[model samples]
Target: MSDKHSPDEKDPHDPQGMRGGLTNYGDTDFSLFLRKAFIKGAGYTDDALARPVIGITNTGSAYNPCHGNAPQLLEALKRGILLAGGLPMEFPTISIHESFSQPTSMFMRNLMSMDTEEMIRAQPMDAVVLIGGCDKTVPAQLMGAASAGIPAIQLVTGSMVTGAHRGERVGACTDCRRYWGKFRAGEVTADEIVEVNDRLVPSVGTCAVMGTASTMACVAEAMGMTMPGGASPPAVSSDRMRVAEQAGAQVVEMARRRLTIDQVL
Candidate 1:
């Protein structure tokens, strides 16, 4: 590969060995200056920038209830990063929602993956935390992280808590196929179906059962990418925030160790 930075460039603050692929072509100092200029408006101090940079990918959207807890999670994660003495920066990536996409979310997954990969490569960070809850989003992020080859850890937005319908336990789906089968068979009246629908989704989070979002969370845990018990907590639970905080701490350590994604894989 061609050199990411030109030799003999003087940048005392530059994490030279760590920050690869120049932010601005042929001028590292000016690049860092320009980058700091824009972000400084957000109140980032030089001391903060001096620490290791951990990029937190924001995959949240108003349409994605599965990732509804994203802002809270990001806050918790940032707390962990700060506690662990790292600079945490949250950046956006393509968000894929299972129900909202026009041509089916799967069709747009590849595009999301490309967006993830390109953004990761373009940004300057020692490590990254991949936040995703949707089915295709997790895999797309992983695929991108795999290609990006940076130190990364997967943090799930978490599953929704189970709800209750008319004193009976219900799930977040608000629309399971079993209920549809009952409706189609005329076993359930339209009024009852509507009533059940009203109660099924009690809160904001991913589908409760082993749907794509929850299933992928389990898959992520199985793959050794997620923290222990990362797949179990409900999205709105305090435990989920704890998991995010721990992930932030771990990613900073990963950065310190210079652990790349290939090593983790």
Candidate 2:
């Protein structure tokens, strides 16, 4: 096998490397100069370039309705970062929504982890705010950050709005499954099940109930990975944007403190 595919060839899967294959921008003098020059070409002034770099992990897609607000969230995060005297750079990574993935979302979580870790390491950012929602994205990001060992914070996309059916309130897969189960047991008619399905996910965001998405959000808080009260806000709420902004500002503080992921984890 070629060195590129060789397992002993410095682990293509590893996110920290001098050559910047996947992690740590290839340190070649030419690559370094090219990267800086290209970034400069984007109209980034020297003053802005000199500031601490804050990376935003954007995992948005039509398939992942959970991150439907990714564009707005990222913009808010950038605004906060720049306002706090940090340079913001948004980057893409795998976006896995539980309902959209094949077999299971778990199967792809590790792949997302690899992508996130390598991307974070490859860039020159002093810190990163992981923007994710849904059942698996946050966990995958945490795994990546744990491996990358950089200063990192998590910002959830927030929960979906509650839906109603025939004057009955409902939200997310838990209630979704419950209603469906009732239909399968002949307790609810087919038309009723269809109506319930439409009402279950009334808007774009993560599950409204304290399901996996909410659970992971809480887990992040419990593990001290998120700001206080970061886990419970509704996705479309202004509070969610405030959380994003706070996340951006906090990353700047983290950069100043030189608090690596090891410290936070």
Model 1 residue 239 lDDT score: 96
What's each prediction's TM-score? 0.89, 0.87
lDDT by candidate, in order shown: 0.83, 0.83
lDDT tens readout by residue for model 1, 1-265: 7444332143655562224455755887676667778878889776676678899999889988878899999999999999999888889998877879987999989998899889988887888999998689999999999999888999999888786766788885645666778999999999988888776666667788877788898988888788988987988999999999999999899998988988877
116-226 in candidate 2: lDDT tens per residue? 999987777778899998768999999998898778999999999999888888998889889988998999998888878789998889999877899999999888888
Q: Each candidate's root-mean-square deviation in Å?
A: 5.0, 8.5
- Give the worst 10-residue stretch by lDDT in candidate 1: 2-11
Q: Report how far residue 44 has shifted in candidate 1, in Å.
A: 1.8
Among all windows of 10 consecutive residues in model 2, the one with the lowest summed lDDT is 14-23
Model 1 residue 176 lDDT score: 63
